[model samples]
Target chain A: MSAPLFNLRGVAAIFSAEMARTRRTLLQSVVTPVLTTALYFVVFGSAIGSHMREVGGVAYGAFIVPGLIMLSLLTQSIANASIGIYFPKFTGTVYEILTAPLSAIEIVVGYVGAAAAKSIAIGLIILATAAFFTPLQIDYPAMMALFLVLTAVAFSLFGFIIGIWAKTFEQLNFVPALVITPLTFLGGAFYSIDMLPPFWRTVSLFNPVVYLVSGFRWSFHGAGDVSLTASLGFMTLVIALCLGLLVWIFRTGYRLKP
Target chain B: MPIISIAGVAKSYGSFTALHDIDLDIERGEIFALLGPNGAGKTTLISIVCGAVSMTRGAVRVDGADILRDYRATRRKIGLVPQEIALDIFSTVWNTVSFSRSLFGKPKDNAHIERLLRDLALWEKRDNKIIELSGGMKRRVMIAKALAHEPDILFLDEPTAGVDVELRRDMWGLVRRLRENGVTIILTTHYIEEAEEMADRVGFMKGGRLVLVEEKTALMRKLGKRRLVLTLAEPLAALPAELDGWHVELESGGSQISYAMSDGAEKGAAQIIQRLGEAGVHIKDMAMTESSLEQIFVDLVGAAAGSQP
Candidate 1:
């Protein structure tokens, strides 16, 4: 008999498969982020915060906390999603997903959703750890959560794009390391964009990660060097752009066909 | 109605064409085998029909629904068992199959899931992680996953390539059961024996073009070559002048005569037997060896390649 139509059930299948794999290596997806966040708090929060004054009416430790959380969100989301997809490509298992009845949208939502969930989880862990170092008050918990999830989803989609583009394992890791890592660091993860001169501030504004970090930081401390509305607008556009690109790639079956 | 209609399908990677203009009509509830060598565009053809690959020029309809224009509807009508073994190693066999069913938007049906697992001889391994299974068992799990969705058409791409004999038998048996249940099964394989044993219709592909598509038995009878061997009661000293016109060879100390036939139109076999009788060589016994599906494939494909520009 012919199979039935597609719907949320497809998303669940894709998402469950993805989540099962990420859970397979809890040490990497979960423990590594926690440990790295702790290290950041120690080195950047205490060491750097000890000497440097606060930029936005918050302690250096608390100020860097938002950036650190955003960094974790962006990196983990991309890494988990990219590696999750890359393994299938290498093992030739991606054909299973591609040939299934599920639409390209379902595949993206499943993988990107799982990646966002992991990143959000790790981001929360970092946020909790930051609390141990410095007490911070949230201005809007709802907006923070929304921005956090959105950032994860957006970056995870971008990571999925990179995963699809990468033909080898080395290429998979290269983009996240060389491109994503450096961009996050320079996006004011450890500092504020206001400290830079006008020319550099304008340049920082161009970095998508800057808007993501700035918007997330604004949600947390109710203040940021860049305009919060502008950051939100940029993040929304980035999310749409990445989503559109992913859908197009999936529709075209680029690098996915036999 | 035909379950899948591939009309003038072609695929290309930049300037290189992977699949050329091709047309195929796969009826519902039959096992159709696509046979070809490596890079013969078997996978590309299946991919296009399943909507996994974009076609450069052509359209495919699954149960009358266009693959590209009405993808969701067409996709829901088929189940694909890809060549690659791509199960999440950490997931249990049961979970993987069940998840695959849900992917088709089917409601959770534990009984259906259990039945598919049982049919594939994977029920006992349901709780085991995919990584823990052997290669053959993993292949069975792939079959189970494909059947989970209960689609009208099931596409198996090299289902038994690395599987063991027993598993292959079990898989074939399962495919037969699926066909009996009215599932249109389209399978691709380099294993000629698989097509010979399981296919109702055979389609031979060469260099992206479908060279021939016919009933398995008809193709064999029409194009299948045969060798005739006759054993004489006494050894012959030399070749007879009357039998010189035949493509005959003497074997076993000149006691047997062998002749090859390209098709049924050749009456040379009867002539050979008549010549032996007329030559005062009493034939003790004789046997005919028919060409295997592999032989027919090689001959047809080899000829196609030789004729290529």
Candidate 2:
């Protein structure tokens, strides 16, 4: 007799299943986000673009584009990943995943990777939609892509953590809708911190999403309220923190083991 | 070789203990049944052995690899059918079972998958979503998933619970075949009858402790008993002095008399009939009742529970 072996085959298997599951509910996974992004552009971009002048050396329409993309990235990533993890617990499918020969890391990669990929796709769709509202430019196209992926990965991992921590369906929606969504709005998704008073501006800097949005904006416009170096450093720090938290949760089997 | 060896394994959730000071060694090619009532920690013990749940104290070795230190190795040798039927409803059974196999790092073996599906009578359902299958079919899928990795030792925690009788019988037969092929199976079930039917050895657990573990037949012979039930033609006012040596219960408005006898080399039903006739109870109808596995289980747990403070 030999001890079991683990390979990416298991990860791929689980990943394939998750992707299939997400794809099956194409309305929620695909159409809903597309419609939401359209609404965001129509309501926030077109309606608010005319009154506000260029705040970050970019037009109001263009300035909000990156924020809009990040908004979709964060919400979609979190929603997809959270629902992905939470549904299994709800339907009892999680037991199959947990009892499988796959390691926890493999489970994380399969689930969070699928979630991040989904978020990136939805964010890209929203970004594409932004093209109709205002002409967008990409100063650092490669960097922009990299930041988008990192942001999706980070937020998806965060959502994965939230999914595990949440016990019920309401608890699942509570944090993302109430906590993360509010933070994104206040993080200057549709506006810049420069317009805020000094105290509020200082306070806004504490929001991690601000750095993500600012970093993403800098990638597109080469202009942001925060320094590029600081934003990149801050995003890097956030990624590390998210990864560390996930690894610790996996190691501890937090809310995973019965 | 023993497929699994559990030493001093214990699991606790905060202040509440789930399993206490448990030790189990399961040999290859045998079905070991863990019989316990609900909340007796049967699932906890199996989960610990299968690497699904962590033990607070002690260790488990699967095929000589420590579960905690060498999880991949240990897990590869084991398959777990949890008490819950957890399946991705949207995914086809083929993908689900194949994924479970690959999760153990086994290469793509399509033939093996087909054989398993066919054996479990799931080949047609392989292309169907798990949610579409009946409860019995889904249970078979759970078994297929556990067998996907071809583990040396499989842990089935209440596998037949709540399942239809046909499916339960099918699962028992499948387990028997697996045993024939040299897979050591550890099963937890509330169905003592299932244990009696399928187990080569049985371990009874009560209050988080294994009360007894022995060969099935040896346990039955040592603890099994027979009760002589006598229906009298006339009501007996009292037992005669000749029957004083035996423990007898008067029932059915004193028209029936029962004598419980511990099984031994010399004791037989003939002796009870002779004793009753000699006592002049004027028996009209007589029958013997043999203790079932449940009776043995009840007796064991009842005695264990009574000894507690």
Candidate 3:
């Protein structure tokens, strides 16, 4: 029999393995993000919001919801994808993947697909938790979903690259912890770039996370520090760059093959 | 057609050459054992064929499909059980095997998987996590995972390394059964006896080059030596002139005589005995022994080493 053009079963196998890992580590995968979101609501929405009142004509408590979800989405996307691939490399089980009748694209689709799904789930869960704290509105639900998915997929791809690039566990976590988290914080996850001084605001424009948060926030409150088109454009650019890098990685075999 | 054909394949890492121009072809449904010492490029060669390592030069084909160009087609036909027990500790025995089958783009065959697990003696522990299984069970799980996709050829890299004697025997039995079912087998091993006991043909590698490849029995017959050892009735001070024509040695302070014969020299043993009898030498006990594969292996490697500058 001729082989199928696509190894859909291979992709599904990787996807389910990653998802099962999530289910197995429910506390780390789901609960921690939800609890962290709750803590943010308790601290920022209750204590801090009671004093700040509103930001950009939206309640301060409601304003940070999109940013918070973006934060979790970005981090979880990176974490899921990076850990998913890195663990196999670490355990030497990647031989099975490398030897299987799988193209690099199929491998990426399986890993990134699961990672994006996970972060999306966490993003929605955080959104629901945000709802319990303050009333929320999704002005463009479809656009919101678009931004959520695109951001998750883009970052998950980036994480897959990190997973391949990393030689050690510390290196595996370095990009997400040292780089992505700080970028998320400074990218107006809690405060708007409009609130930043002029000079710093221009520098904030250089931070890619700003575009993601702004686009997601606009989907929720119909307002953002940047234009919606710019946000979407930046999202597309990030996705394209990540995909390009992934292609090169697989083509070159990078750290994945010896 | 041969199930696997490797031609002019070489792999190098910067300044270090791991494998040097190697050409080999493995026949269908036969057990081909690759015997070599460490750093002899056995694993590197296997890795190149299995697509785990890129070859710096040349091509490999599985059933006429080029390995690099038709990777999916070639890879689908081969299963590799690497030396290391690489597995997801968190995954259960069943999921591990099933996942492997799916990874090869095979449709879910629960029945096939069940039978496989049963065959490997892992059925009862199918639900148990890999970490929960013993080392031997984990090794069997690796075998199960490799076979899950039902590949036409299997490459076992040191399959019995670190395994207990009984488990090794079980694995040997399993491999024989696999061959009986028409799965071509290529195994690289440090254990010469494993090759001697199971291989139909054997290839000897030394320092990244395949030095010798021959049918196991033929190799033994060609390089094998025979020794006729006799316990002399009395301790002799020296060999008699009549026995000097034969390659004989006096051991145990001249209390025993050992007659050595190379291939096609078995006729010499009877002459040596007659010579000893004519010389009034009496034998209290006599025994004959043939050289083992291990001895032939050491001799080949030693010769190769000696031939090196």
Q: Which numbered prediction scores highest in lDDT against the true structure?
A: 3
Per-residue lDDT, model 3, residue B63, is 93
In candidate 3, how many Å is residue B233 off?
1.2
Q: What lDDT tens digits, residue by residue, belong to model 2 across residues B1-309?
A: 577888998888889988889988988788999998889989888877776777899978877778878877777778888888888777789988988887777889999999999999999888999889998888889889889988888889899989888888788888888988989889999998999999999999988898899999888878988777889999988876767766788888889888776766236456666777887668799887888889999999999899866
TM-score leader: 3
**Candidate 3: where are CA atoms >4 Å away?**
none
Candidate numbers sorted by DockQ from highest down: 3, 2, 1
Candidate 2, which segments miss by more than 4 Å at Cα? A1-6, A52-57, B227-264, B267-288
lDDT tens digits by residue: candidate 1, A87-115 = 78887667667766667777888888888
Instruction: Give per-residue lDDT, candidate 2, residue A145.
Output: 95
lDDT of 1 by residue, B117-183 (tens): 8877788988998889998888888888778877889999999898888888888888898889899
Q: Which portion of correct inter-chain contacts appears in model 1?
A: 0.67
Mind giving the per-residue lDDT tens digits that candidate 2 earns over A113-148? Answer: 999998888888888877887888999999899988
Question: Candidate 3 residues B58-132, lDDT tens each?
Answer: 899999999988998999999999999999999999999999999999999999999999998999999999999
Compute the interface RMSD for candidate 3.
0.6
